[model samples]
Target: MAKDKLRKVGEVAPEFHLYEADGAKVSLSDLLGENRYVLLYFTSTEEKSRCDRSGCPLKENLEKLIELDVTPVLIDVDPVEEHKRFKHDHNIKFLMLSDPAMETIKGYGVYEKVNIHGIEKEKIVSTAFLINPEGRIVHVWEPKKIEDSIDDIINAVKKLKGM
Candidate 1:
């Protein structure tokens, strides 16, 4: 992944209109609710185990995020059906959005060319971002692995709410 291409803190998040795993339409504007923040997690389908382990913390602490007025969302290039299956399989309580076109994935600079079993392909490199209601990226929880990022996200949220 090109560091220069990645969206940074304070930058306005790129907008997109995507569908949830259940096929419901959604948009960045819709999630940026009044006085709230948006927590976005871009997942990798090829690394489902990683996805599950990374997502559990979010699922576990979902109520805390809600109480803090932060809406957590997951984005992946998987199809609506795949997303539906993954969501169901993982018991994800947050909105899992589909992005088969990779529009938003590339827009957010998370899309990368990766090698899988000797085949090179494009996909999102599991990422998380915390965005303020104003549409700006307040923080990127990618300084470490997915596990640490999730913790950082929650701690960052709590810290932001206190500010």
Candidate 2:
């Protein structure tokens, strides 16, 4: 999908039912509740390691995020088993969802087909979305906007919730 077609701030975030690292099915609504928020970060194969900048930023601030009632979810095209190994390797306790079928990735307009080593593969366009309890996209961090997204997300949630 094209970048322009992505779900933007103020729109209702797309619904998804994906498997977590433990192979448990989880839906978008399952994570929503009174005073709860979701910070979704899409993963890319470009990151050399699970503990790279892409994953650690949020992991580092996980406690503060939970204190604010926000759930940090990292979605990737990898399989559930891969997500499981990632959690084990990196000590990730947050939700790491698998989207091997690319359902959620395409729905969010973050899927792009790229050839690596002359073999075509589905890749994710790095993106982040902060969804409010009502499932509305309140904040978005596209590739270029994510220099310090963990901080930006926290501040956005704080500003929105009057914290």
Candidate 3:
């Protein structure tokens, strides 16, 4: 299958509304409406290999992100209950969104159909995007290694904010 084209920097991010782990709805526009920069991550907790090292980069840079006043949001194609459990297990303090239907995931061009554990399923690719307060995508990281993406992400945010 052909991969969906990713939204590039300077383009308006595709708007989406998904539920957080607590079942609270969150919208991109609402987040931008408050002038908050968003570091959006498309991820999944099912793959042990990817999941094992997935959140470390974000977790390592959480304090720096907070210092920059950026809101980190993790979007996964998993159930709300699962997301809640994952967040708890990982000590994730930021918002963890549930995209069970993969609507928001595909909308962002991060959904990939792959074979996992010998079963075919649509899973989210490991990708991150930084949206500025004006709702434009300021940075994008299509990391080859999920665990090694933090430095690039942090540097992009710093460059975008002129810090």
Candidate 4:
């Protein structure tokens, strides 16, 4: 199925339902009630180790994210089992969710078919989104590499908080 168009800032963040690492269901509404903002990264499930190396920048900007009190969420577009192991192996403390059906990925408009090893493969765009207390997308990060500097995400959250 074709993914939805990229949403703009001020639009209500797209709602999603996916399995977290522990098999609990997590949705946008659940997060909105817990924190002032949510920081999300969409990644591929087939590539577990690579997801950390490519789809994430939290390692580089974790402190900044914490400073802004933004709840970090990782969305793995792979299988739930893969995500479970990935979370365990990495000792992930933040929210980690799996969306094997790609419904959530498409809802966020991050899934795309791209050339991989000379073959077309479905993958998520290396992107992140920050949603505010009101559920509006306040920031977006689309990097050439999955591991972009998270300073931007932190700054956006800080700015939003100051407003």
Best-fitting candidate, scored by TM-score: 2
**TM-score for each predicted model, relative to the true structure:** 0.87, 0.89, 0.84, 0.82
TM-score of 4: 0.82
In model 3, where is the ten-residue run with the lowest total lDDT? 46-55
Error of 3 at 56 (Å): 2.0
Better of 3 and 4 by TM-score: 3
List per-prediction Cα lDDT, in the order shown: 0.81, 0.83, 0.77, 0.73
TM-score (C-alpha, index-matched) for candidate 1: 0.87
For model 3, the superposed segments whose C-alpha errors exceed 4 Å read 33-35, 47-55, 115-120
**Tens digits of per-residue lDDT for model 1, 49-152:** 56555556667778988988999987887788987887788887899888888889888988778889999988777778899999999998654345567667
lDDT of 2: 0.83
lDDT tens digits, residue span 29-87, model 4? 88885456888787654434664555546655666677677788888666667667877
Q: Could you tell me which residue pairs clash in candidate 2?
A: none
- Tens digit per residue, CA lDDT, model 2, 105-153: 8888887778899998877778899999999999888753344577888
TM-score of 3: 0.84
Deviation in Å, model 4, residue 149 alpha carbon? 3.4
Candidates 1 and 3 compared by TM-score, better number: 1
Residue-wise lDDT of candidate 3 within 1-163, one digit each (tens)? 2255667788999999898888899998877745468989887665423555555666667899888778888888778888788778877788888888888777778866788799998767778899999898988877655556777777777776677
Best-to-worst ranking by lDDT: 2, 1, 3, 4
Model 1 gets an lDDT of 0.81
Clashing pairs for model 3 are none
